[model samples]
Target: MASGGSKSVASILLALNLVLYLVITVIASWAVNHGVDRSRETASRLPIPARIFPIYFPIGNNMATGFFIIFSLIAGVVGATTSLTGLHNLSQWNAPNLNAAAVSSFTTWALTVLAMGFACKEIELGWTDSNLRTLEIFTIIVTATQMLCTGVIHVGVSEAPSITY
Candidate 1:
């Protein structure tokens, strides 16, 4: 179990991560809906040959949009679970599960970094729409923040020496 100061710091960081996750999810949902509408409109204008040819099809946009949506959902779920777990640990204040809490934070940070990498690749390819791109940039920023907070939580909780090693 963590001390009072460590628990308080971890709680604040976890709450921040949770809020960022929610924001990222909302922005991603907007981007996905916008992409779908834009894709439909663009598809209607494409020639039959272009539509038939897989190479010419705008599949990259669809794929990126899907990635954004899926990762956003994943981030949200992970954040929620992490926050809930942190709350449970805080309530108990016994500290046996501090390592688990640290592991959870690390996992959240890794996932956020993964999502950011995908988003950056899509941005580099210039496949996303302007609105989607803006939202994605925002998501990236939020993810970065969440990642930082998780790092803090991990550091705060990992100092406990429950392991024999």
Candidate 2:
């Protein structure tokens, strides 16, 4: 089993990530739905260059916002799943479980980073709605949190005493 402190740290981080990811999921879904609902009206106002794209987001830098939304949604789902697996691993506290959790957490962190890149681009392009801005902030925060969670899990796995049959 891992040290008590490491385990607790991992648990807290996993819980935090779960909540953040869920929020990201909800916000991103809302953004997508909002865009779809207003697509016809939005499309009419868009420039010819923007009209070429299949999925049109009416706010922000259209292309960056669209990519940001898509990636944020993907990262949110994956991060939530990773958090669940991490919770299971915390209960088990064994080599195999830790390894699995570590891998998932790392993957989630990478996805979050990808989403954060889009968020940065969206921010640079400017003209985002409140919801979109919220999603961007959450994505940026999740990226950091996910990295911390991954690091904590990795440290726990390394610090855990080896067991032999």
**What lDDT does the true structure give each of the candidates?**
0.64, 0.88
For residue 151, model 2's alpha carbon misses the true position, in angstroms, by 0.3
On residues 23-106, what C-alpha lDDT tens digit does candidate 2 reach at each position? 999999988888888778878877897777876787665588888898899999999988988999888887778888999999
TM-score of 2: 0.92
Best by TM-score: 2
- Model 1: lowest-lDDT 10 consecutive positions: 50-59
Return the TM-score for each candidate structure.
Answer: 0.67, 0.92
Worst-scoring 10-residue span by lDDT in model 2: 54-63
Q: What is the lDDT of residue 105 in candidate 2?
A: 93
